[model samples]
Target: MSKSIEAVKRKGKAKEATIESKDQRWHCRNRITLVFGSNDVEELETYTYEDGKLNFKTVDFHQAKSKAIEEILDNCIDEYYRGHVTEIHCELSEDGKSVMVEDNGIGFPIEKVPQVYSEFRTGSKFKDEETDEKGFLHRTLGQNGLGAAATCLTSDEFKVRVRHYNSKKEQTYTFIDGALKVKKTKPKPFKGHSGVRVELKLSKEVYKNDVVDEELLRKRIIDLAYNNPGLTFYFNKEKYHYKKGLLELAQRVDPDTAQEFGASAYIYEAKNTKGKKVKGKIDLSVALNLSKKSEEREKFISFVNSTPTFDGGFHHDRVRRLFVNSIKDKLARNAKKEKLTLVDNDILTGITFTIGVTMPNPRFESQTKRKLVRDTHLEKGIEELMNKNIDKFLRKNKEYLEVVMERAKSRNRFQELKDASKKARKQKKQRVEKLLDANERKKRELCTLFICEGDSAIGGLRSARDKLYQGGIALKGKPMNVAQAAISDILNNQEFSDIMASIGLIIGVEADVSKLRYSKVVFLADSDVDGGHINTLLTNFFYQFWPELFDQEAICIAKAPLFEVITDKGTKYIETPDELETFRETTKLKIKEIQRNKGLGEMSPEAWKHVLSRESFTIISASDVSRAKEMLNVCFGKDTSLRKELLMDEDSSSSTSVSVSSTTTSSAKKKASKAPAKKAKAATKKKAKVTKKKATTTGKKKAKKKTTTSSKKKK
Candidate 1:
């Protein structure tokens, strides 16, 4: 305040401000950002199509500079929309500093060329409520008429050559240094198709860098070609022509999955400024490339009129919201049946939408037209288009609906796994309530976990197992077939949860062998058919999620002895009937008593000791993962027919064996019965023969004795 007062006292009064006026060219050169967009360069995430593939990249994008060139191209597109242009040719110079655009269209009057290119707010397309000869409103890309003129005023040298179709006259004009100098040629009769050509080099002082991006320029030209059907474009001697325009572009992104998504055109009526009824048409083209396998987020490439709406404003939002609602309404019943809540991402992921709209007098947020502003007519057009075509689209793309459902299921499963992981981490800190832990805490890799059949088996194992290296856990019954159960179901089961906690395992995570509580997991159950089933069930549980454990030879099976035999030599534990037969045939010891164990609870301590003393167990392994998976599916999958076939095959084989055994037993019984009868007959005949011989011998003996007595009496 003191400095201000001192200055005021010295000057005796405040100095009056001066006002100055600036020309259009001077204003455009200084405030180029306001007329076009940002003056400096920025990084833009964009995509381009090449080699039949779409590639995404981050590029240095200069908005104002790009808009300067697009302004000229927009003029050509405007002429195309009016049905006067069919082909546009664009080229970038070798030095990348200058560009030329030529279009084959009916050029305006030759005398208006200089004013059209150099003056501000002075060209055509300002009458928004007018209609063309067809009684439809004029739909064009240029409405304000300042684009080409502003571009002309911000350039180092701007040249224009126009050949009027009606007049059959041609003229050329050149403006130098922001139109500070102007030159023109005399009008003359022309020979070729009527058109206009413009060549310009942007001023380096205003642009900071005058060189144009050649790749971006070519991309823009090709986008225009795709946006305008039946229009031909040439850039750097390369030709681009499309009949199905945006649909062709969508196919370029992904040919197999691309399809049209909406109706082509919507027409409405409006009153002009003169209160005359006029028809306004909104031509819409929507193409979508959907991928069921991709995990990426959705992408949108949209345009209003012929301008690329990179920022995607009202049109994009309206279409996206409506499309999502349409799909949600269609899948509501299915989602409810599956107990799922579908989010926008689940419906929208892996989809690329290419949308193009041509409407009269479209509004934009800024002069660059990167983003569109809301328009009532456009909104109503979109709503009507979606209502007319969404049901048909869904009907045709049934697999797409299935894909959305599967995505929802996967998202739900992922969240369940996350919650399970948190619960598992909390459980990992506490002791497993039912686990009989091993004593080897320092080196857990040396420990073995024996998953026994029941509590009785675990009790026996507790007494017989080596406490230092062996641990035991009991299964209530067969473990859940993980293939048939949901992740949440498996996680909620008490037995499975305890097992994972005991073994330091986390669902949905890859197992590390060294970090596991036990190096070897052995399934110990009764040596019966049910026990065999339990072992297979356990194998499927481990192998379905953690196959690496099998690869490391950590999954194994321990054979529980079915028989304990006491002999004169020693006690033997026999695991199978064949093993007992082999031992009986090979040993020389005297036979004693044999005890057969019907279940693990009936096994003797000696049998348990024999099993625990084994050096190693039989490892369960799969050489071919595909075959194993198929077999498991047949056995444990939801399809009962597959399991029925497997069991029927097994029953057929068992029936064959039974039939053979019964036939052998019957023949053996016949042979034994016949031998007994024959043996009895032979014994009776021998007895008779012996009796006859003995009688003869007795008579002879008596006669001899009487003769001897008479001889003795005579003596």
Candidate 2:
């Protein structure tokens, strides 16, 4: 503590926390302290960096060092697999702690062994049939074979024995004083499997502190398992826990999902050699944890045939980008941010997917399989050069096209999907500005907002709210209309800003609605014409902005009475007009017309109590926030005029449920719409762009400014 205070006092520039010694260096941010490097690699013991780096007295320099070394080893192993090796095998030791991953498809046949381990001697060539199965000419994760070599150089004793499975020639390698001791293994008949067995022994230099726990490594195996489902990975013969998650995501892409999405999905298959002929279909992988900005996954894994391409030298990255962009083009969801961004965040969100593309002629830039050159065009509208070939291929394959559409149809899975968007904007708004403002207040309880028509109704609701419930009510006047506001403007708006602050939600640019904890969000309105319109507005708000309500089942519409029977005295009570009339006719009670409370405003605060809180009042089911957004098209996504005609006009009618017809017209529209935006592009670039949609009502009201078009998107 004294050291920190002294360090703080000595700090001159606006530098983050830092500590230093002759042998070690450290830095910190958000109270997370990181010890970057250390000279003493031998006496290393236990590590404490996993739970996080805090400025505590017990800083385990060993754990930090071990993690760094493990990362280096991870890269090295990745390289060895891509390096002079063809087959890769990963299996856990009997106890499930120790993991063994080896490959036998190919083995390193290098010239001058010393030259192989040199940092500058990257064995990857642009395209060589001997090293790569195909010309892996695309952006990949394993830029250089340094990954595997780095591991050999760092570990105490990790043996690498490789031999071309078919060639029957073998070589043995081990790290000795940061260098590989290369030798030849005895040639024998193939035994168990044909891959390098990395018997990683923790060196006092890296895992001496026991940082590499077998259980932890197995768990880590589960994470990358999706990338290598083909490779039989076992934690002592136990497959992995990710299978359930992957299968679940894949289930969403099944036929039913396509039917629901209408036309957003496509299961495409094309034999590159056959051009337009039907050969095989290409389905995306289930990498569901990958959000719109999948940079983290992309940076680490772009596999080719179940192999993690750490260097990204192969066409893996290129194929992925093209594939995702193709999907975006169909959906027309990709929109540039500030017109400067090339891709938006939507590419990353909502996709826990892996795309498999095979390349026979691999053209790589380096020894590591980091990039590829092939553009497996969909063969559709975009030229094969413009990813049109792949699109065309998918378009031709109805079976797979239907599958893709099925996955796209998942738009209805979350209730308040619109409220929670594909993008997060937290930096734009001030959190404290939204706290406890006079116009709004919040509670974690089942408190809900009754977005009514006017202030008179607001007054009635506030007074009528159940005194026992921690209900908070606010009058929405000329809301910035999330339908029209920019992310910045939305965060700056009065009510949203207030709600975000008061409710402890990160709003605007900082909004990560998936983390919200609201219990209920009720949209209270009348049963009249305007009442319906108001309902639409509130639903639109939840759908577009407060999506967490839908994902969490918190958004609902209030069914305040359109007609009521109230007694003047003898307990001024509220009963549906039907009950009042029946009582007057059956028994002998004084009958009265007693005008029905036209709107919420007509009722006093006391009357609102009985109407809003009493068990007698029936609450209408409101779409969950995200669900409402998905169902908007099903409900009111079309032009207001069409919805109005369906709801009020007697001439034509449409259903409230979403309907997607697979007719030529609808298919053509779907085909033309594009897959969606490339959320991947948003991460590489700086600016952010999110999903957007149109908000609509049957008629223009006094509260909101009418727009020229009903295509108001709140993405």
Candidate 3:
């Protein structure tokens, strides 16, 4: 009989007992006939419910039980799916769907194989990864031997077989209540044989996510095929469908002269375990065909232990400095300038290298082992190693460096467009049906494009706007980054064409986005924070897509009032309440308190017309763009927070509050309302709440007070 162990937890203590694996098979999978198995430690807990939420009241963990079982289970899986078995002879069936290997040394004992599948089982970690090392990469991140049970949680239809050398007494077991029923089954005694085999069909839940598992699993199989070149891994599955990423560049230009090889890109030297000196080898692999973007800079990708560092995280950055430092001498020889300020892009781009180092205590970035953060050494050793090796390689590869630098300087931002133009010119096989289907979804929708805020005192402006002005007004949203997009991807993307279609503008190759005709172009963003930012993003997009629109002055930003006042007799909207107060003082008129306006949404629709109009609004006057580009850079450029600091600087002479969104239509208009920006920091300093009181003329109260005075005089 196959034996199993159960992990039980009571009020405060833990308990374990042997049980049958068959009954518990349903606890993992639905099929009763399917045999259940585990190859790791088991942790159990009893939970109590409080207010419908369950809390673990007690827990139990079995670490050492059935340690042999899990390793056997993993071996079976790796063997069945083995792409290329390392040094083992494999035989294939007629269909190649299944194969039996001849040299799987030390197969599980058939009697012990049942015990391996039982619960509360595990395999020791120290023996894996070529050493009894304590590393997460070798160990299955804190899992008790429960993988077999977890598999049953998805699929129940699976079977396993095992045999060891010279064990005549063999047994086959079907699942019973947490146990296996072991009737004396005959073993097919084979020659030179020892190994376990497992076959499984994934249950519906296991392979969900719209077949995401198919791609990852396929890649895993393919990676194994290439990785273990010496292994005899049999493959019967159909070819996996995915665009094999280009390893060699396509023929873009013919070379006239002989090319040189043997120059290394990076070399690393580092000390290994036991504090002894060792050299680390890092050879960069590159594909330098023009088919790869001509502007490609340091595209050399780096990896430590098969982890791709695309973002060049902190550890990668540490090593990148080493790559540049090694070549600094070589770089200096090329330029007459005494020093070159090597930017982040220069040291990176167009380079790919693998750093194979001896990290005995491998601390991974994650359980899946995608990255190594080098948490312990601060990656200083990797940086040192990179410098030593990569510098030598740089001295020998000066010619390639010159070519890369020239391309970087010469490549413009419009290369993508040129490539698309070429592809369309080739007249490749036209997939007319797919193109028609794609066009069916391009229905136009109506939307009002608002480019408000640059126009001064936007009173009664939108009210007079003609509905048919789409013929004259330009309405487009911000220009988006389409650098890495496909031609069709850009054409169908909603963000690209929605605003243009919404405003009656037709998208064409020659027509710029700003030049597109629209019903209205109004800017109605917030008046305080980020008003200038939203304005600049919109303006930049317009300038990028349609510079011709600026000539017609079609783009306009609507200005709204900053303050409102209410008195007993009337209410007034003011550009600046301080000015209104001054106006009242100069006129010697009794006035009520002022309240600052919040946003366009705060005002009613009627008040919206009164506060946010376009006809009375002044268009932003174009200035000699001496500071325009800088202003654009401050708002939309990389150091936005720095721009915020500059605007808020207490020591600057000409600095105004960064919240200023609109420039005046004329210098006179710009000089007219300078109070709001002058007091810009007041908005940030204190968001004060002011309630304007409406004075009420109460006739009864006035008469009663007068009568009381008259009565007192009579008395």
Candidate 4:
């Protein structure tokens, strides 16, 4: 034990020789000692543990420096808590190496300054009794005095300047590297005010990073200001002033929380429990709002002695139990009239609470106080006190209470509907499963649900498809226009309900994807305009709520060929005009006949088997679902203007093609109709011209004969 003690001491004050050859140094070897003291400085005792389980762990220097700053700032706050200070001003150096805080409180005794700096344990505020002659027990922070001593010992320099207005004197003490360097005392002819100003810079050798974080320091300053009402805090040229205490803080955290409650926030300060004034009173600030979603959880923030008890203790539990019980009891009496009752979870789901407590001699689990321990007296005291206040508030605001009860009723109704739907879906699915023979197949095999347009289509699929791996659901006529209908309407439709049941899916808010029965769902429809429309309707219905169904290769469209051509070579199936052209150009075979499949009813079972096979079909995939949704909206949405424009453009182009064809046919008919009339007219003109020529020739022949006879007579 002696050797261990010597080793620890040497390590704590290790010289340069023990340090490694590195530019940076670390002084994490110093050990902590617990100190207890009294009003008289001579009776101080230093405590140490000799157990082998002792821990000499080093703390993070950034955090240690922050705690040191907090210790100094907390001392100033203690003065305010004791009714000694009114204002506090904190300033951080631009380089963020040091911090200074000055207050307008009564300064401490100056003669004991050197001893307080050099000694391990020496200070005031240690009393066994509840109160002294002045009735002041000092319920303020830093009652142990270890915090201040540790801060000075860990710093490179600690300076204290005091102005004693009461004594009309001034004093100053300076500590350099844990030693008292200078102490000065002088008379102030006219002392303006009295307070203590402490400025400190942490020792670089003791801390990994000694620079102060300005933003974190500001938040702490503001929080202190908030908790200590009527105390002003100024830092970084900004002022934080809060007079309403926790109520103001709750408002800042969530502003609309109180307003939505249909009443102002409920603020209560405990006066006494069971007609006896408690030593330290607890304060409560509560805000409530009825959640539209019943799944939302309650939120709570708690504090003890202005230090956050992030891990809640007995006080928080007491507050919650009392609050919930108070409301539940009040609602029980009106349950019959309101036709409902509520549990604790239902009542707690809509509340936001902030609790504050101030204790004179508070106990914590550790020196770095992250949590508070049980205080039996405080627990019972706060519960009894809060019960009455909460009861009064609930009774005063019956309207808000009604809203909360109504929400419970709504949630209950919703749960009942969901349960009923689940039951119905299970029963229907069982019935369909029997028909599908779904239990006979292996679970890992590829199973598909084939949705066809009509009973005829289903007949074709049933004969052609492999029944063990394929199931069919035949939609009557066309599927309901899902875009313009509500979910309830769709569910109530017999065809859609049957289709949903066949697929083992529910059609409402509690829809579950994991419960889906089929691995793939393929729409097998006739290759026509009506078939495309039905496919569109089905796609819209599924994409509206369950778009994730398409993430896997589960949903697709399988094509059915429109034309079957028999030729000298063999029979070929064609879906588009280009396919026909390719068949004629590539095969160059003598065509026997062409069979056009107007619908699925025209196809024989063998043809259906040939067409429904995976190789002969084109499966269209939705590459961009968002773009598909946009197109579906324009084509199938309730608004008809956009669809009307598109249809009009298509019709105008089709009408133009019809008009050109009809115009060419009419002109050819007119030309054929005029051919006989033109032939008769030409024949009549030819006859008239020949008759005139014959008449002229006859006259000329008579003249020539008379002239010839006259010439023979003359000869």
For each candidate, how many residue pairs have backbone atoms clashing (under 3 Å)? 0, 137, 57, 0
TM-score quality measure for candidate 1: 0.84
Scanning candidate 4 in windows of ten residues, the lowest lDDT window is: 36-45
Where's the lowest-lDDT run of ten residues in candidate 1?
656-665
lDDT of each: 0.86, 0.41, 0.40, 0.63
- Please give the lDDT score for candidate 3: 0.40
- lDDT minimum window of 10 residues, candidate 2: 23-32
> What is the C-alpha lDDT profile of model 4 across 1-715, one tens digit per residue?
3655443434465456665542111122154212211111122111111131112232222345566677778778777777889989999999998889899898776677666655544666554234433543446666655666667776788888877656766687777775535545564543577898888887776654668868568767876876788998899768888887766656655455542112122222333334533333334343343343446566665666776664667767877887777777778877766556687767777566666767666677665554678876566557556754675666656766676686776676566546647655664654553233334245523567778878788778777887667778777778888767644566677776776676666644444444566766777777776776677677777666556666555567777778888888777788866888888789878999888888877876766777667742333345666665755665667777855554435342233222112221222233334555677789999999999999999999999999999999999
Output the lDDT of residue 443, model 3: 27
Q: What TM-score, over all chains together, does every model reach?
A: 0.84, 0.37, 0.35, 0.52
Ranking by TM-score: 1, 4, 2, 3
Q: Which has the better TM-score: candidate 1, or candidate 2?
A: 1
RMSD of 1: 16.2
Ranking by lDDT: 1, 4, 2, 3
Residue-level error in angstroms, candidate 4, position 55 = 36
Clashing pairs in 1: none
* Candidate number of the best TM-score: 1
Model 3 residue runs over 4 Å out of place are 1-103, 118-121, 126-149, 165-188, 205-216, 237-321, 324-341, 352-361, 373-388, 407-715
